[model samples]
Target: MSIDQDLSHVQSLLDPSEVIPPTSPLYGPNAQGWAVQKDLHPRLVAVPTSPESLARLIAHLYKSHLHFGIRGQGFLSASAKDVLVSMTAFDEFHFDPHAEVATVGAGQTWGAVYRKLKEAAPSYAIVGARTPAISVGGTVVTGGLSWLSAEYGCISDPENMLDAQVVKSDGSVVWASTEPDLLWTMRGGGGGFGVATKFLFRVRPYPQAIWAGPILLPRQQLPTVATRLEAFLASNPDPRVSMFLYIIRKNLLETIGAFQDMLVVHAYDANGEEHGREAFKWALDIPGAVDQTGVTDMEGVTKLQQNVDKSKGTMRQYWAPLFLKTLSAATITRAIELVDELAKQDSAVSDCTYLIFELFALCDAKGSCAWPRPPGAKHVILIGAGCPANASAGQEEMARNLAEDASERILGSRTVNLLANGGEEFHDPVMIWGENLDRLRQLKKVYDPNGRFQGPIRA
Candidate 1:
């Protein structure tokens, strides 16, 4: 059947308000998340308001052999040339303090979850996305990385992901755990099995107060900062303390025009202000630094990080993330040189691009998940570049090439949370699924034999 026939057939099976055709103004906003996703050109969007409706739609698409892509927050890449299943209508939020689990709807944003949890359960926090705008479903299934991960591990870890409510391809809605194999794959297996409607995440006890913020230093101090960071990681500091080192145009966040570079040291100590101050003393003592560090609640901290990490979605963005065992001096120096090279080009890419090195101190405890922290892995470095939305294909390719090249030179493994798109780039299935490749393949066969879902790990 033609794309139009598929869309028309699906449209008749749903409520009028739920079917958004390409001609609708809402189509543009609903179809895209980041600028890079703007061209997916889904013929129509289906917004199912309930699990029954979602299941009904999935079943029709599956049986009819119609191609579709599920979209939650739109951060991840998706193509629905035929139909785009928008999970936005599934927004629901509930917190069971006694059970220590937050039941988040697939469409809910992390920001809303954090704010609500703060009031509903003041002393606890869920292992959620660092950026408030991110959706829970996308972040969790894609291997969630959080500021709290140092203590709790990935949000999708088996221990934290108490259960997931999924609608299988055949239109059956059930708890993922009901099928042990289904649950295992959903726990950070990188989403392809089914559509998750709700998630039950175990929450952790958090103090009412904590210290976290940014410390900006001169760009030339990259060497000193790198040396201190390497030593700090090797010293085996408390797991509660985490840091992110990155270089950005001084004007990237503030002001406009002539751009000067600066190194930002963002530290987070979950243990209240007193212990946090002492824990990050080395960073605090650095001279000529602009310190924005202070004591705040979890919600406050998330908002602060979001303020800087959040993007307008107006520019085309490409990301390359590397998982390294350690931060080496040579790696840091090379990163700075690349930054300099981009600056010299004096192009649009330079004005908005930046490199971030995230330091994750894995909790001693282990978790069963797709990409558990490798024995020695400690850093997840991300090279992100952006370009004008109207730029030519060459300009867009330039942005992607820059990100991919930087990550290759940095030397680290690819992570599903950031790189598994089932696309032209990063095509090695083994790199994404690793040792679990065989097991996941078997599970996919049993759960989705027809390959009704589009997954990155497929052969």
Candidate 2:
């Protein structure tokens, strides 16, 4: 029960490989993550290979009061603390075609899950990260967005989530999903509820050749193309197609040009290539444009997200989002010009993407998640930027400022997500969570009375 006992009990229950000491050379390897959340020391780190190991580790940390952090695929990183547990060893994938769902491990990445799911059922898929490195746990907890989002809604299953095996904050193992409030919070509440070892997500069937890929448009035709994109999704347009507009410095948009040049990074996902091309012919009509459109399997969906790979090893990044009601022509033009302006100012800012998440499925469902948005709001926009590690403080600050200004314009004292606080630009959690903050705080009291989970919320 004491901290100085060396946690011999935790080591005894699992294989020797599961326990990683802080003094060992592998310490840093186990402590590292995709995003460097903060600076903290991890006195003890363990990679649990099974749910039982995780549960036992939790019990030890609880008795010692050494709040732990769950590092899954290093997607959501933070400074290691008293204890750090890597779910990487929990990577398990099992898909039941008859049940039409996938029992995926939290440690598994979208890429790995996709590969296995395709082998088991290529005709079926689930909402997941667009990159292989993003863990299924992070994506599902944070309202995962995917190419098939228009049809399937958020990648996490709140309504259809079968069950989740988790180690509650009190160091007891429990299966969630049947608990309405707790399940809703875990569905999209961004962790902090409990340490989930595995999740059951309802798989969706494609039943056809999926046509999807990026289609670059002429930089000069930003206005023209933006208008068409807005109109394409204005009505009850087919939910089969999803769009993501990235307006970045023309230099990054293409392989060549001045650092300040800008372009519209447009992409499409559809049941078929012709359907995708036909859906946005107005954009194709533009002259002197580059087309890199191609069809790939379901696994290829997350693979196309090249930014994650490019940002590896020391790249500094920031993400700020806003859920907008509509994408009018004027709104689109202003957004593009804003990106150009921001890129011109901060050369370190590689690109700023306008991420649009289909919210049609969110219409009939309100108050279903802790992350709140206005009614009739069917799209979520995020202006994210990545810079070299050596980028000046001013450069990162400028990027944060640009995104915050745009978000406040529509969100109005309400922020979709908090801005980067380490480098000075900080947005209050109240802005991001608003009224939900109180609810989560109360929920934390019920689930994690001691706030031992420490995933996102402080309460």
Candidate 3:
């Protein structure tokens, strides 16, 4: 069939307002995503309002041998020129207070879901980071880990997952939770398995207030701060607390000195005033030039704790996630050294080059859903390097070299979610693809035997 014929087929299967042809303004427009460097342009973009229409659209695409890209809030990396299937039109929500569950459409943003749930139950706990703009579906599918991750576990924990409405590759709509195996895989398998039309997530009751903010310390105090942090983790390893240590260059000093400003520590505690006060005591004990802290509501806490406005604009950020058996003093020192070296080279384009150390205790492996996790792993430390999009070729090369050096310095199992470098050693098919690849292949063979849904990134 001609391209026009294919367009007409899809149009007949969807609402007029839901379909965007190649010539439409949003088709080839410079659409911005979370990653500033990547441009989003699709062969065609389709937004389905109803589940039946979505199923028909999938069937038509499968018949035409055209694979499509799925998007939620246009966040994350952009890949391929295939037809784009946007889930923004499917924004419906239902909350069951008795079941402690909320069923929401894939297109709905976390901000919307949080607001609705807040009204239904004054103390509903949803797994999400500070970014209110992120879509719940996107975050959950990618193994949603946030501030509460250390305590309640990752958002993909099966105890919290109830069901999902999905359109399989073959255009068959199935309530996935009916099957245990499929449910386990789909919870954290990401969009590679299928298009999740709706998600049913478990919620919990939380306090009305929280304590969170940034604690800026001078570079000279690294040794002291590191020692205090290590001791604090050793003594009171409460999962209710989350801490992020950023080794950043001084924004103003970048133009003046050889090395930028020192480091800043940001921490969060979901527990109310008393717990937050106790948490800040550790920060006060550490010798630092400046200390900025606050107590606020859940919404306000997330906004202050997780905002990354400095890393905005066009920049190519590469992430490397490490799951350490333990963050020993030796490991902490090594991490600090790596950050110091990167700062000296001026490798990070903006304030982008930094290490994010996330400490969590994942002892109860069987309690959560079957998302990929490092066997016998306890703590996770993600070391990321963000560079400017318009950086010179030589600078970009330096950034890559710095990332490699940092990864090699830290010894631990790596996570596929943060693997961006296309090097051969890091390109383990099993790690990157996870079990979702195999499950996707099986589903594809059963549903799309003709391989009509092959897109830029083949599942």
**Candidate topping lDDT:** 1
Give the winner by TM-score: 2 or 3: 2
CA-lDDT, candidates in order = 0.75, 0.64, 0.63
Q: Could you tell me the lDDT of residue 137 within candidate 3?
A: 69
> For model 2, how does the per-residue alpha-carbon lDDT over 147-261 read when each residue is reduced to its tens digit?
6655555665454455677787666777785676777676666777878888888887774466666566667777677667677667556777666666444546447443444
Model 3 C-alpha lDDT per residue in residues 14-48, reported as the tens digit of each score:
77888777677765432344555455456668888
- TM-score of the candidate numbered 1? 0.92
State each candidate's clash count.
Answer: 0, 3, 3
* Candidate 1 per-residue lDDT over residues 305-418, each given as its tens digit: 676424545677776666666677778878777867877774777766768878873452265776544565656777777677777777777777777665565554334323
Q: Point out where model 1 deviates above 4 Å.
A: 35-38, 253-259, 307-312, 412-424
Cα TM-score of candidate 3: 0.84
The residue pairs found clashing in candidate 3 are: 158-369, 250-260, 250-261
Model 2, global lDDT? 0.64
Q: How would you order the candidates by lDDT, starting with the best?
A: 1, 2, 3
